[model samples]
Target: MPKLWNETIDAHREQVREAIVNVTSTLVFEQGLRAVTMSQIAEHAGIGRATLYKYFPDVETILRTWHARQIDSHISELTQVRAGAGSPGERLDAVLASYAHIAHQTGSHDRELVKFLHPDERIVNAQNQLREIVRQLIEEGATAGELRDDVDPAELANYCLHALSGAAELTTAEAIARLVALTAAGLRPPQS
Candidate 1:
């Protein structure tokens, strides 16, 4: 019984997990993704290669895990942005504000995420989901007559997503402004 309790606690040791994640994030940020290896991660994580394997099977696993966490966070933020009451345009601006914050936080973690993105199928799916989220918001905005009807919402969303991602290079304030302007331009109702 004591061993079982200990085992479970050890499994959930947040410090260890964070140490691994931080080490890897830092490595990728500084050296780019290709520079890091499982052996290096194991070394930086202060664990043996075999031990690290017990936690994550491969480098791709760790990368996917980190990317998934960011995606999950983006989803949560979107949920809040959607829940808040505002005009469709206003809500999109609000959501983009939140996204800018996320993108700029942690030494531009989002930028690092962009840099490390692998050409994997899963990464493509993640990008699609983000685009879809943007598209849906545009659609809702258009339905509210807060957006133009001429452009396809899906295409607009995809374009805005790329635009916002490109703005990740800017300061948070700059990114927010850019996002606001871009979204407003995309969503502004047709001239009467």
Candidate 2:
């Protein structure tokens, strides 16, 4: 095949895969994980069952692929949040709040979905990346005397990640903000 022809084929395949991932996500959200099926996904995606099968062997594979995409998007969002205008302390605050909101939004997802998607190595690596983002901010703040020097940055990073996770259980933005505030407070240096 010509180069242009090959590029076109690759692009078309990506579009089809994107459609499959999106349609399956909507179906899973509407019908629950176990209720969704390959046939339903194919119909919703406007693809044939054979095409769907060619792209994904099973529903779990589709869901895992969808989750990987979500994780990648989230990491990009957090990186942007960290890079947003602010002093080190201010940037840290924004990153922590952004993460809390993300946790709150995703927390509403099906518990079974969370359980299934979280054990993958991709999730473990994404989590480590998240912690590294937090750790860098904490170190920056500490260097500027904005955060506590009494604790290790790695420890504070762990503390912030675990602490803000409670936002998932919170039902209100006000409540999540309060939780973020409390978590951020723990990072501040003690007053004389």
**What's the count of clashing pairs in each model shown?**
1, 0
Q: Clashing pairs in model 1?
A: 147-187
> Which 10 consecutive positions of candidate 2 have the poorest summed lDDT?
24-33
| Clash pairs detected, candidate 2 | none
* Candidate 2 accuracy as lDDT: 0.94
Which ranges of candidate 1 are over 4 A from the true structure?
1-10, 13-15, 37-40, 100-116
Each model's lDDT comes to 0.71, 0.94
TM-score of each: 0.74, 0.97
For lDDT, the strongest prediction is 2
Scored against the true structure, residue 107 in model 2 reaches a CA lDDT of: 97
What is model 2's C-alpha RMSD?
0.9
